[model samples]
Target chain A: MEKIIVCIKGVPKPGSIKVDPETHTLKRENMELILNPNDRPALEMALRLKNTYNTEVVVISMGPPNVIPLLKYIYALGADQIILLSDRAFAGSDTLATSYVLAKAIEKLSPFSLVLMGLKSIDGETAQVPPETASLLGIPSLTNVKDLFMERGKWIAIREMDYGEEEIEVTPPIVASVSPLAFDYIRPPSLKRLLEVKTKEPLICQVKDLNLDPQRLGLQGSPTQVIEVFEKKIETKGLVLEGSPEELVEKLIEILKDKGLIKF
Target chain B: MFEKIKLEDLSKENILAYGEFYKGELNSSSLEILSPLKEIAQTLNKKLILVSLIGSLENIKDWEEIKKSLADEVWFVINEELKDFREDLYTEVLVKIVKFSQPYGFFFPATKIGMSLAPRVAGALQVGLCAHVNNLEVKDNQIIMARPTYGENIIAKLISKSIPIMATISLGAFGIKYGEKEPSIKEIIFPEDFVWKSKLKIRRFAPSKKKPTKLSTAKVIVAGGRGLKNKETFQKLFELANLLGAEVGATRPVCYEGWVEEERMIGISGVTVRPKVYIGFGISGALQHTVGMENSEFIIAVNTDKEAPLVKIANLALIGDAGKILELLLKNLSK
Candidate 1:
């Protein structure tokens, strides 16, 4: 059976992220870890394909071992397999090195008909991994993918352009990133099936097992370096307009008219 | 006395700026980055070079006009296959350009296309890349780029620590500046041996709605946010917007609530607009959202909470109920 790989990440639950007042660094401790919210649609897309076509869905994440629970969360939704690409050596990898490690893992699990991922992770918030991974794997990729369907052995992707949407088709072994626009289409997971999802121990892969160049496996392979992180000092002009609702509207428009924003 | 920078910085080449022109001219977002990138180039005594990709050779004629009017030298990438943005193909072309040029510094607009392509280019070349970068400082020959991260709450300063320093500059972050006359243009034919395993074929496009609001170019914009409790009150914003000939916009939450169409939402997840006048009702001015419209010529915000962050940067902060103010505005304007 063909396999669909969903590259996922563990993100700090919203309202759970706390910043250290002094260092301005994110304090991940004591935060509830959840599946990156945006990745849900990609997971749903994978499940939808499985329901239509007889395919196995594998959800993969790379973080600390604590990330395993987030993968189990995917199993509860219907993923067939899970893998955690974790190791001390893989820590502090930037987007480029992160994509490199992910590409290697995807290559090891070769014969994937499609690789689905979220456009941007909430924490990292960069949509580069999907294409970077495709580049490393020698395949075509698309970003901002909102809709996908199979036709004549090719995947038709509905991508959200800046002004309009465009439909594109390409034979898989392709990588496609899901846009936030796809969130509305995700179906609810069944509670009963979620309970029955026998959680299996996720297979783990280390840097050595992937046979990656030792020099390029972690921080050393990453290019970007953070010099300092500090709180942004916002200088706000304390200007307040005093009036009733109607008076405020009238006065505001009068001022805007002065700025040539309104006429007559 | 100010002495010249450290010896290591002296050997760096000219600054290469990457962007494209739309409808015969560079877009406002591209110009915004070019202006600031140009400033940096001058500070470092380096020439500013703009490299753009054109789908056809004919587009170069349009580019020639842009060169004469502003900027230093312009480089054009004429590739038939590269007309449309295919991530794999664009990455391939960009990677090759970076290799051949070997620019010491680079700038790309942080549009959807740039955000998608910059990281891959940075990955391919093994260089550092900062996203939505707004500030740059060079000290001791080291370039430091700073950008708002963690939902715009914290600022992170990044250094390339490698050969080519790169950043994807956010739109509306800087002002555009013009350079001397006698602009130069150079053309490079795309590499033929470029490799993409398979091609992504464009089948069709969703019918364009030609939204009447046209938020980006709208002279006046009245945007609603989570302060809109009901769809009825949300409609009041539209009524007010129509009366003033303003475009109707909303924050992400308003769109999620189905109060407004997704395309009408303004923020990081939506569109970035710079209208002459912006009236935001109930917006707290989150960095993600403000990054979209902060460049508006003037801003007036109405929110009951005086302590809301949105009130801070607003030119005129009216402490009141958003819905009430919007309704009154519509009532007065309709008169």
Candidate 2:
């Protein structure tokens, strides 16, 4: 089957993030996990390709047991298959280690023609795993892909550059990262379809099953470390204005004029 | 526990600085690395080298002054195909160079281009890297880099046990300035037999005619956020911006919603701006957006909700409808 595999992460929702002062580590106690906001675009893009072609879309993730429901939600969203890379050994894997494990799992699911991922995860905010997985798998990769389509058996992706966008083509068994801002936000699948697939279990791939080296699995294998974290002082409040819109604007203009920002 | 190893075997080469450029001219953010890196190079007693990939080869005329005054030695890898950025090409070429240099320290600008490529290279080498660091210090042969996190609510001090420590520094954190002394130069040829035999192809190249809002260099900026609502209302930001002779900037969601151009977005993922005067209309000051603009000299945020994060940061937190306030301000200013 012509298939595309998407790498997804289940990240804790933004705003409730709290760090432990004593350990200098992220405090996940009572935190609600959600599908990473950034990865939705890539999933949406992959689903679009599936609708247009004779292809199967697969959603793959490496997270705790909680990630299974998320993969099922993706399955409900038109994914043909769900694969979860979950194991105690996979805990504390940084971007490099995470990509290594992901590349191995992807290899296990062979005959895949394309790989799609979001630009970065909200929690770690590293944005490294997608490209790193592409490199480890020895495939040509494109980052910041805003627009994509299949033409003449090649994948055409418009990548966002510093000043503008550039269009490029890559042969399959290649990787492309979707920009969160580039495409239209994903629409919800029908309620009936979502409920039907929410209970299906994803195929779980353990550490040993992937044939990865034990020496390169988790925290010990990662090279960089966060020595400490500090609560930074926010800048003090500026000026507070309470009045009608006209009065507020007038006060603003007065302040600007006082600062020589307005002449006359 | 991890420190009980021989440090002598580590790759202790010069500090490697990535040279970011647009067209043929160097980006202003590129110069931010030179001075801080020079200090670290001295502390480590290693040289500071520039690893530049020139998409279009020209005489050192454009970069001569920077080379002479800031860097110890300059290394350029020229590939005419590099006139535009291709991730496969840039990553492949940079991987080869990193293998050659084995840098003790490496710095990248915290822009979209740099953020995208740096992680890929670090992943290729299987090392650790800190992203968007605003401050850095080197003491006793260890690099301590401070990076903001959790919406700028916390600052994380990072250390890389990896031999070649890598980080992408924030733009305004290390302001670009000129230096005086002339430095030396060298060139490394792009690797042969390294193209991987037509792995990827450029089907088409359509450059975005849109330029970065020039918010960083502007003296005055009038930024709008989601509160402005639709594209038609967002256009009012331009009207106010023009009236004040200011540049236009927007929150990330505004750009993501297509109300404003993506290039005009200001946030951790977009542009970092520190204009003399920044006026926000209907902005909620999410950490993502505020991180990119907190350095502004004077901040004026307009919001109907007085408790919004932007209100806390603004020198003038105007409690009102952003659209209404902007309309009145525009009308009164013209009179």
Candidate 3:
């Protein structure tokens, strides 16, 4: 059977993660982790492809050992196999280093026809890893894909552009990053499947298993380094106006006129 | 005929700025980054170079306009096969050009194409790339780039350790400055020996029903949030926007609720807007949404909760029911 690989990530649930007000550093201790919202579309597309072509859908992620449960959850979603690439060496990997490692893992799972990933992870929001991984694998990448399907043994992707949309066609051995909003809804995993996968251990691969260059694994392989992290402080005029809705509307109009926002 | 000429000067390093054409015109975002690049090049005392990959200069109607813009030199690499943007082909061509040009730094606008292409080229070149950086500065001979991360709540400063330091800068982050530079245009065609075919092909394109309103450039924006209650109330925000001749924007929750188009979402995952006047109805102003519009010249927020984050940062905070206020504002504006 043909193979399709979907790259997913576990991100901290929004609002649950906090930043140190003083240092502005991320506070991750005991933070709740959830599947990246953007990655849901990619997984949904993979499942659709699986149903259409009877292909085996493989899910891959690069994160800590604690993310194993997330991988199992994906298994319950109908992924034929799930692999976790976790190691100390993979820690602190930037987008470039992360893409290198993912490319290496994809290489190990060679002969796969398609690789799917989210347009951007909500946490990192770089939107660079999928294309970088494709470059390393010497394959084409279509990003921000709103629509994708197979036609005449060729894959068609309709990518969202700034002003419009462009439909593109490509052969297999390609990478495409999906836009989550395009999908109306994602199917939830069944309770029975979740219960079954909970007892099964995910296949974990460390740095050494991939035969990656030690220099290209983690922070050492990362070319860009975060020197400082700080909160962006925006100063605002603390002026509050309290009145009836009609009175407030008149005051707002007066202010708008004062600011040259309204001629009347 | 293509010439295999190589400039082998290892001592001199120049700043390379990527220029892009959108829909047969020069993308304004691509040119705006040149203003900052000009400063960086001057600070480093290096020549500012503009590089473009094109199928033909004839395809770009504003090629002459771009050629006259501020740059020491403009290099246009042409190939009939390079008509459309194929990530694989573009990355291979760019990596080769960067290898030969040996620039000190490369800058790209964080457009849809740049966001994808910059990282691929950086990966192939084995270099570092900063994504959607809002600011750039030179200190100790290294360029420090800063970008918002973790839901735009935190700004992280980054530095590249490798040369041809690459970064994708946010659009509209810097002003566009046109200076007097009669740049020498260099046209290079790929050699016949370099034969590569793109596996990807452009099938077709479907433009939007109407010309999309870009919230980033709008002078006035009337935005709504979940506080609007339902789709009917959200529709009123558009009516008010129509009366005010302003663009309509929405918070992430509003977009997720399907009250507004996702493109109009103003938040961390959405478009950053810097309008002259931004008025929000029923917006609680989560940091995720505020970061995108906080830079507006003036902000007026209407929410029942005076203590909402959005209300706190707003220039004029109205402590009242949002839907009622919106209706009153609409009536007053129409008159």
Candidate 4:
């Protein structure tokens, strides 16, 4: 049977983000952590592939020990098995370092026919890790994939390229960064699956267990360092106008013109 | 103190190109990189080098002239099969040159072809690579690169810990400028018998032709959000944009709702714009959406919410109905 691996990230839940006024760091206390929104599309895609082709879907994530709750959630999504790569050494990693660790873990999990991931994580928004990860593994990869299917042991994908859409056909051992649009057609998780997931335990892995190169798996291995993080000060104050629609628009146009936004 | 250099100074730095002109003249993205290379070279007082894989030295006369307009030295590698961009061939040729010359820094446009070649080069060299940089500067004998994060909401500064720092600049970040003085150019020839491997096959080569909306370079831009309600109201926003000779943009929600296409969205998931003038109609200025266009020279926000975030950053904040304001703007512009 074909095997597939789906990489997921547990991030701070949306609509619950609170920033510390002083440090500008995200407040973790009382904030719920869940799988990244984009990862749902990846999970759904994996599940569809597994069900259609009688394949095994393995979900993997790297985060703190507190991220276990999210691993359970992935199991609830019909993933056959899950692994969590939790280690303090993996903290404060940028995309490059993160991709390094993930690629190493993928090597350990090799022999799988396909690998899947979300196009980006909402928290980081770098959108570079998946492609970088594929490069490290030396595999053909497609990004921003809106649709995917398998026919006669080959994978067909519709990818969003810089200039237009591209339909590519690649044999197995391919990586794909799926777009959120792919999940719009998925049905909600069934109750039986949720209950089964809650009663199950995920296989956990640590950096030590993976035997990865210490110099390339964490903060110490990272070549790029963040020098500073600060909020940008707003420089322009807004112009407030309260009047009839016709009057307000007339004033707006004049303002735009004076600013050279509109010549006439 | 941060010192700035003029574009003309780039003629002193070494500029190098790899591979032949498969698709005609150097890619536009390459030209964009040359703009900053010229400026950065002047600041560091380095020589420019250009490396080519195919065609005779005379065939690249125009490229040499453009480079001579700014570059100091050019290296040409003549190989019949090296005309097109191939990962294995390009990587092999580039790695050898980069190892031999040991340039202080390297820059590539963040195009698909460039993206494919950059990481491989970095990996082969055993160095770190920074991608999608918006700004690059030299300070205290180190290259400081700035890249947008959090969907352009935040700018992250990074420096290479390893030698020969490499980065790929986002396409729209650097602006092209002409230098005043004609540059001095010299050519170097590479010996034959370059080693190459062919592991990947080119099943097909078709252009996607997906053009990024030149929102970042627009002189003026008109944006809308959830408040625009429906396609009809969004149409009014476009009308105003047309009258102002500006491009039309939308918020994330509006784009997600399919009220407008994704290319028209502005904010973290959308394009980062620094237009001369920006008009926000019925937009709440969510942090994700605001960062993309916040750098505009002037901002005008029209929304019923007086305390909306859009109002806070706008130079002119009009507190009124977005639909009504759009209608009035269209009427006045028509007059």
Query: For each model, chain A TM-score?
Result: 0.88, 0.90, 0.92, 0.86
Measured on C-alpha atoms, candidate 1 has an lDDT of 0.75
Q: Model 3 over residues A181-238: C-alpha lDDT tens digits? A: 7788788997888888967887899988998998986678888888888775655466
lDDT by residue (B169-271, candidate 1, tens digit) is 7655665665667557666654455553328787786745775347767789999888867888997887777677889989876776678777787766556
What's the C-alpha lDDT at position B236 in model 4?
81
lDDT of 2: 0.77
Across all models, the iRMS values in order are 2.6, 2.3, 2.0, 3.6
- Candidate 1 docking category? medium
Write the residue-wise lDDT of candidate 2 on A37-87 in tens digits. 888999998988888887989889998887877888888888889999888
Q: Report the C-alpha lDDT of model 2 over B1-335, residue by residue, as the tens digit.
A: 01211223323388888887667767667677776888888788898877677765663346655654477766666667676555667777777777766788778887667877787788777788777776678867798987667554566787888868988877656566555666555556544556633466766666667655577778888999989877887898898787778999998778867887767777665677888899999998877788788889899999988888888888889998998888888888889
TM-score of chain A of 4: 0.86
DockQ of candidate 3 compared with the true complex = 0.70
**Model 2: CA > 4 A from native:** A20-23, A27-30, A235-237, B1-12, B59-61, B81-84, B189-198, B227-232, B304-309
What does the lDDT read for residue B280 in candidate 3?
91
Q: Give the TM-score of candidate 1.
A: 0.88
Q: List the candidates ranked by TM-score, beginning with the highest.
A: 3, 2, 1, 4
Q: Over the stretch B1-335, how does candidate 3's per-residue lDDT look in tens digits?
A: 22323333222478988887655667877778888888888998999888788876577788566766778877777777777777788877777777777889999988888888898898888888888787789998889988778864677888999999999987666657786867777765556677667787888977777776678788999999988898898899888777677899999777867787888887656667898899999998876687678889888999999778888889889999899888888887887
Please give, for every candidate in the order listed, the TM-score of chain B alone compared with the true chain B: 0.83, 0.85, 0.89, 0.73
**Over 4 Å off, model 3:** A18-29, A234-236, A260-264, B1-12, B267-269, B286-288
Query: 2 or 4: which has the higher TM-score?
Result: 2
Please provide the root mean square deviation of candidate 1 (C-alpha atoms, Å).
Answer: 5.2
Q: Write the per-residue lDDT of candidate 4 for residues B1-335, one digit (tens) a residue.
A: 11222222323224443222444455455555667677677777776554455544444435544643444444555555465555555666677767667777766776655665666666566567777776677788667887655432455677878667777776655555555555444333344444554333334445656565767678888889877778789978767777778888889777767777777767655666788888888898877777677788888888898878788898888888888778767777787
